[model samples]
Target: MKRLTLIAAAVAAAAAMHAPLAPAADKPVSIGKLERVATFDGAMPTGVTVTETGRIFVNFPRWGDDVPYTVAELRDGKAVPYPDAAVNVADPADPAKGFISVQSVVADGRGRVWILDTAAPEFKAPRRGGAKLVAVDLASNRIVKTVVFPAEVVLPSTYVNDMRFDFRAGAEGVAYVTDSSLSGPGAIIVLDLATGKAVRRLNGHPATMPEPGFAAAIDGKPLPATFKVASDGIALSPDGDTLYFCALSSRRLYSVPTRLLRDPNVTEAELARAVRDLGVKGASDGLESDAAGAVYAGDYEHNAIRKLARGSTTWRTIARGENLSWPDTLSVGPDGYLYVIANQLHRQAGFNDGRDLRRKPYELLRVKVNAQPAPTN
Candidate 1:
């Protein structure tokens, strides 16, 4: 017994010597400091964009919330009806005349803020003249243009999720939109800013459609198999040559040449052949690009922000924390900060068996990205 005890002590000592002397303190890996810019206690905000002069704008979709105004400018922590309250009034009779179920607001960095009106509340079909893009001139705070999508382009099941602009494309530039339809196959809608003509590309393509049998897991709980969103997050390259996009239910990122997308002559088959799968980026909601050519994505599954540097194929986490619950949208501002919305979308009543697990005060968070907003022109 004495010999056995000695042997055991020697083995224990050897193990202790090999182990970390102090069980190295658990250090959380974070690349940037996340700063809370604002909080939404009333209605949840889905999209956020900052102008070159630092004007912050956010949109609240009519998703079962008592949204007094669909679009608002965040000023002094208050949600003020943007441009005025008259335009925000949802007139079911004249849905195209005002903001109805606005889904995203994007500043073109060229003194224009574009509001994308999905006009499909509760994921319902859009009314005639409801689905459109309204561009407001920032300097004048006046509606400069309203392009109502045709019935064919904005399909009955189409949910215009997000869009990015490239002013260098056509005479007045072009806009690329993602149709993240939950009920139907997804596709990309390209709008010619000059003629207000919209064309659908990659319609029901495999890349745009959600991955079969793939469901998102939030907070260690896998979402229901029925929960699938396709072709949601989108970003434009700095040189205006490539457009990168990903589906909400997929981790794979894909890019296609903007030249082909802008060309009406390109056939669907030819365009699909040009799409290059950029491999897995975490399940992302919103994607943004900087003037430095790096693309940033809100990695909702990891509660983090990731970046794919120019000429690099791998994604690196830039910011991560528990507070980043459901990073829903990403916008790179002119102030060299990447703004994100943590709206806890997975906890919504629809996904949580009608329990609405979301807590109050959804967050508008930003992290210093050391990069400026991509040039719109």
Candidate 2:
């Protein structure tokens, strides 16, 4: 896939591309073990979602992997294009016309799978129609609707990473997306589902940007400075009142009132005032909220998942181990199990001196939990 070559050329910041390896921790933390659900011998999978009926779906970004399909349905322990292979094929001339690079696939409780298309393969500049939100009818396996962001909304440097849906927000629903742009400012993108209007909020806010002195380490070595990823993970409280977010390179968690974030009238200054820094919770890549208001965070550096309960000042590790390599995105399935993607992203080619270091048989694992998807429409 030439992803390493593409990323190196895309960043063009040689200074930020190389770094020294840090020392590994002496002992590994022990929590709970993850049960293997499916394995991918090809491309590394990131996002995972299980429908109320126990339908499992996953996505693979064109991050240098030979992904036959960007989004797939896991059936009989294999990944098959959900809707069809044609939808997964991108139009070379116009990548936005089809799925170019998919970063996340979310199954809202309302029986629909929402795919967040970054549209910028190899982390290149985003095209006008490249960044979009596509909703597929789970029952019919057909695309029901699409929402494309305008250039002004999804800037060239924007890398739409993850999203959460609040079906109760607007007439149809509302979506909160994170722009984890490595080379530009990071912010939250809000979408009014009924109108298909997208707005950028907290643009370049301190909370959304990568921590100044923080860098994620893998195999006892820190990633290049250019590997800074900001505002990559997001989650919603059970009551739809609070929205939690974190930077891929950060250890602290932050939150703001959904009401303030949804209110266009709330000025940026006001929204900043509403944001609360919830202290450190380990360097994380993804966050998921359960019906009980507990937020599950993926601690990438420690190969663990931590749970932060309502009103808690500290995070408690729920799962951890060497097998949980680079715990990427997390989903609380309808079957009351936490599904996680251990794609070994830190072991990818980009971080391994331009040599693909990802091992075979990427895993989709689940651990039994007393959690359910947060209520949606």
TM-score of each: 0.91, 0.92
In angstroms, what RMSD does candidate 2 have relative to the true structure? Answer: 9.7
lDDT of 1 by residue, 1-377 (tens): 99999898777544432232111223323445899999999998999999999999999999898898989999998889997899998776877799889999999988999999998987899877899999999999999999888788888889999999998888899999999999887999999888888889999998898987666776667778888888999999989999999889888899999999888899999999999999877788999999989998877766778888999876777787778888988998888899999999888998888899999899999999889998878
Per candidate, the number of residue pairs that clash is: 0, 3
Q: Report the C-alpha lDDT of model 2 over 279-344, residue by residue, as the tens digit.
A: 888888999999998999988877778888877776777787778888988999878899999998
The TM-score that candidate 2 achieves is: 0.92
- For model 1, name the residue pairs that clash: none
